[model samples]
Target: MTAVRPWDAFTSAEAEVRAMVADPRWQGLSLHDRAHVLAVRILVTPDGDRWLFGAHARWHLHDPADGRWHPAPPPRGTRARQGRHPSAELPLDVIPDGPDFLAEPGSTQAFIGPDVSERLTEQLRVLLRAAGRKSELEYPLTAFGEIFASDVPSTVAAVWGAIMWCAYAPAFDGNERLITVFGEYLRRPLPGDEWVRWLPTPPLVDLVTLVTERARAGRSRAALRLAAVMADTAQILLSDTRFRPRALALLTMVEPVLREPTLDAGLDDDEAVRRAWLERCPARLCRALMGETDREAHFSHAVYDLVEALQFARDPRQAAATFLADLSDSRGALPARLDHRLRLAYEELDRAGLTGTSAGESTEPDGFPVPGRVLTMPAPVTEVAPPDRASAAAVLGAAYATGLAWGGLTGAKVPERGLAGQAALVRRLIHERDDDHF
Candidate 1:
């Protein structure tokens, strides 16, 4: 940490910051207690400028004369001044996990200027220490190093964003906004030297756990936004061999949310971000997702999610066919009815112009691809393949492979089952879940 501190200009930089937030006492705090530090705003100014932090909507300036910092008096017009807020008072324990990320947005100062980055850097260090993230120590340092040199604003933003979001999520009400800021920053082009080299650092895997646990508990938006951030971070690292595994781990964590049946994954605008994520996906990540279709992780995903993402593939058709084969080859037996429905759905899409040979482009909206496990199946009218004796299990006890395919094609949506059919399909699915718990 000292290596990156600006020693040339500020003769007593390190001493000043340490005085405000003592190292020994800070180090003794647990994860939850340290997390309350998130409510504090620690900012620094340009090199050679004053250092500061905020609490209770007021500011505290570091006093260089005495090497200690204290809250300043308010303006003359203000009423009796209040002492330090309860948050500033050290509590016995600060629980790390909670229902929301920022249940309490604390601040003592109205304005904590930007230069306190090094101070923020110290806070981040304390966090890692409490979380036992010795492996991630260097990342915050890199962030501070860049901010100190005034080199790359983008890199600084990534580091700050990752750390802050980690501290503020779930119980922190401001988590959504913080996550949004982080995602937007990462979406821009951050070179290899700027961010990815720091990937094995923080946001650590703890964030992944947070999203996985509370996503369904009304934090879906926050969770998905973080997913997008992780996705964007993964995109940045895609080309770097050193960080590629870390990138893959990030994407793997979001797969569950991507499998939401509504395809919204809890957000209305999830599709656009979802598409961008799919386009940047590495083939290896894609294969790993397909592997998750085995019996054990079946309920872990929505059947059509991966299939829908394949539209952006370099070879959409091949990906689709392979994924189809993956499903067939996976653990449970493919219900012939559903398999036939899926093949027909693919056939319909082909007929509608998705020759399964699209070159990484959008498929026709009306192409109508169907998933094996759909809440509602599009009612398409076509000639059914006359079943062979064994294939027609209607009267038989056992069955055999039927090489024969469906008969001559007919056309048109079943007019009788248009909107009402969809509504009925949903009703059935809802009732099944409600009644039998299936």
Candidate 2:
């Protein structure tokens, strides 16, 4: 397959030296007088092609059939005269920093070392570029229950396996989405009783053993995937008192990986949030069902963009919308609907409370922090009306920022808002159309 240079992966050695040196990937490296030698780790996708990632600026594709590497813009090194048959076989071709600007792949200095941070960062960037049209950031922060819905169980299992295997870096909160997704990778659905009939009673033990062995053998990626799977497994076992022994055993097995710094891992994380939400969800639901008053269900599901939550709640109004909502409309809500729910919940979370956590504490039981009212007052209704300053300000805080930023952005670019005098034409048309319709 053709390997394209990822737009984000193109910075010169001099320009990115500081950032690279600080990276865990470049640990214990001395470049002194020599040029940069990128330890390219090729990620072989399902399409029988590979993407070589790690070089500072350049990219490569290796054809497995004959075992050859190909770089874009034919290399012009000492090996250039040798004919580019096998990239690995090619001689170290150091060209000056001119038109054929980038370094050659077969430079004697080039070697293969699997990088953790830089490699994962590039992988995530590539996924964003390929899978999404926009969003340097992506998805619901942590939905431990969702990966079971994926159709590709084996693939999911394998990917999670790799992540759990390789995820040993200290608490890295740089990419919330990536870390969250890594945890989600473990959300692989557990096989039913029938699927597990052949195994020991508590299958998690054998699974943990296998994962531990793999991790010891330097299979970090697979280890990561298993870590995710075990996380969900532990979540399911949260209510099983009898299974405590097995559950504790499972936790012990995966504790090493969990110790690695990850926002989605550790005691206060998505699982905590999930468990807390689950514990209170039923009570919140009952409250919503009981509401016969003019008041909305303060603790309902409307606040969370349940669908977006399934994906990282990236919609901005995430401030106001993510907290308390109509538990009844738990799936999702529009900005307006979410706003309404927040107002409703705000009134009831405490007769005198702000955003209702049963005890009026900031974080709920499961480690999910309930957001206080970002908008102290309700947003004014706008129906061809003047913009409400409080409503707009609330938007910056609790509501969507882009929803309002668009006015200036669009105006500077194409000025879609028409002339003020056009109102006369609009009024005339309304009058004319009213008579025509009647």
Candidate number of the best TM-score: 1
Give the lowest summed-lDDT range of ten residues in model 1.
398-407
* Candidate 2 stretches greater than 4 Å from native: 1-121, 125-225, 228-438
Residues 1-438, candidate 1: write the lDDT tens digits: 557743321224223333434445654766555535522423334332232332222233344444333332211221221222324443222222221121222211100010112333344343323322212222222233322222333223333434332221111111112222333324342211210111112223334333333344555554454445444544443343323433464455445455652343444333443343344444334322222222212211122222223333333223333322322112223322222323444455445543322121111123332322332222233211112211111100000001000000111111211122122222222211111111
lDDT of the structure predicted as candidate 1: 0.29
What TM-score would you give candidate 1 relative to the actual structure?
0.19
lDDT of 2 by residue, 4-120 (tens): 754332222224433443455554444321223332223333444443322223333444555433332111111111112223442232211221222211100000011123434
Name the lDDT value of residue 84 in candidate 1.
28
Model 1: residues with Cα > 4 Å off, grouped in runs: 1-137, 140-179, 183-301, 304-338, 357-438
RMSD of each: 29.5, 26.1
